[model samples]
Target: MILPEQFDQNELFVLTSLLIFYSLLFWLPNRFPLSLIILMMISSATVARLTDHLLSGSKMNLYSIMDLDKYELFDFFTYLLYAPFGYFLVYGYDKFKLQGISVLLYILVWALGATAFGEISLLFGVFKYKEWEASYSFTYYFIMISLMLLVYRFFKRSYKLHKVEIYNR
Candidate 1:
């Protein structure tokens, strides 16, 4: 997309964070199948967009992304920002093999971390709020990450079943 006319915190945050996360995405070992990575990114970005619509849309109007109160080019890139994070979230979940109550604790830790990072984004001008608080995003992150973990498990089971079927065939 187009860069902002001026180099500011908003641009710096999105671009720099995107670069960092994408680097981590690639640098990290392949802990998941390619399909799962694709799924995580798609669902992560979609959930981000949809929730932004609900909270930031004309009706609720909780916050603004980037510079303006309106959606801008960087706003789209900001969604790109969420994709790699989703992969890492589930990647760590699987790597730990968290079970039972541990799953709940894992989601809680991720939600807290996401909320803290989001506050960093606020400091960097990635988000400006009118009626929203960083605390609220903790709930959003918790629910979304929990859903992603469920999706990962479902996909893992399906992949195993499909592989076994093909091998038997």
Candidate 2:
């Protein structure tokens, strides 16, 4: 069977599915500050998308399950799928306040979840790796999770410090 072009049925389904799945986050109460979550979501999504573009599109010229024929509109939408996932990563960590071994396990669980999602995407034609292995995605998720946790910690610390300074004044 021939695959549909960019903006085809499969792409639309994936995009719509992402939106619906992301919307589920609204039903849950957010433990972290809303402002912080939004900030992380925007920054993480933008940075992640750019990183993917640079590595997959430009540097490696890697193949994709989505149409990568010149970074079309649908391909851009697929990147958006990560925004809510990013939010949840920080949200879950902050909500639990995981530390020590707990933190390690938490991150590992999320990384594994991400890897599973990647596999699901591959099955659904959301991604077809070219010169890339699923194991590489697990590694990527681990690194991204680590960086995100560091960023969240730094942001939270800075915000607390700023609050203290303001109160002292």
Candidate 3:
């Protein structure tokens, strides 16, 4: 894991980002069940991978993650960065109980923040644009985040129903 020869700014960026993000997440009080937490973590990483695959594929060639155009070991670690992001996104949605017009404002704020984070990654050499602009991702982030919230509600409701059924039985 300590390959100083191959280690570069991109790798360092991922490591540092992971440390910071996970630390912040761990510091927060538990707001959801452990199973839901696990689900959100895995699903976020999965969504990142799937999105990256589609956008960065040869057909689109929108951008390159980390060093070369191919997916490197560092790229895998980069996806882990999304787990905490997804958690925070939905966490706030749940924690704040955002409703009505406030929900729209919340989504706008987060989409902007994510776009800004993407720009920071650009500065850190974590992403190289071929024909892509960071602005393009704002809409993508907005839609994805909205979907995540919906999924969270569905899962939360389902979990409650499941638990009630088990207890009643």
The lDDT per prediction is 0.84, 0.74, 0.85
Better of 1 and 3 by TM-score: 3
Better of 2 and 3 by TM-score: 3
For 38-157, candidate 1 gives per-residue lDDT tens digits of 988898899999999899889999998877666678989999988988888888887777899999999999899999989999999888898998778998898889898888778778
Off by over 4 Å in 3: 1-5, 164-169
Look at candidate 3 and give me any clashing residue pairs: none
Give the deviation of candidate 2 from the true structure as CA RMSD: 4.7
**Which stretches in model 1 have alpha-carbon errors above 4 Å?**
1-5, 164-169
Candidate 1 TM-score over all chains jointly: 0.91
lDDT of 2 by residue, 29-57 (tens): 75566677677888777876877676677
Largest lDDT belongs to which candidate? Answer: 3
Shift of residue 46 alpha carbon in model 1, Å: 0.8
Ranking by TM-score: 3, 1, 2
**lDDT tens digits by residue: candidate 3, 6-50:** 777878888999999999999998888777888888888999999
**Candidate 2 similarity to native, TM-score:** 0.84
Best by TM-score: 3
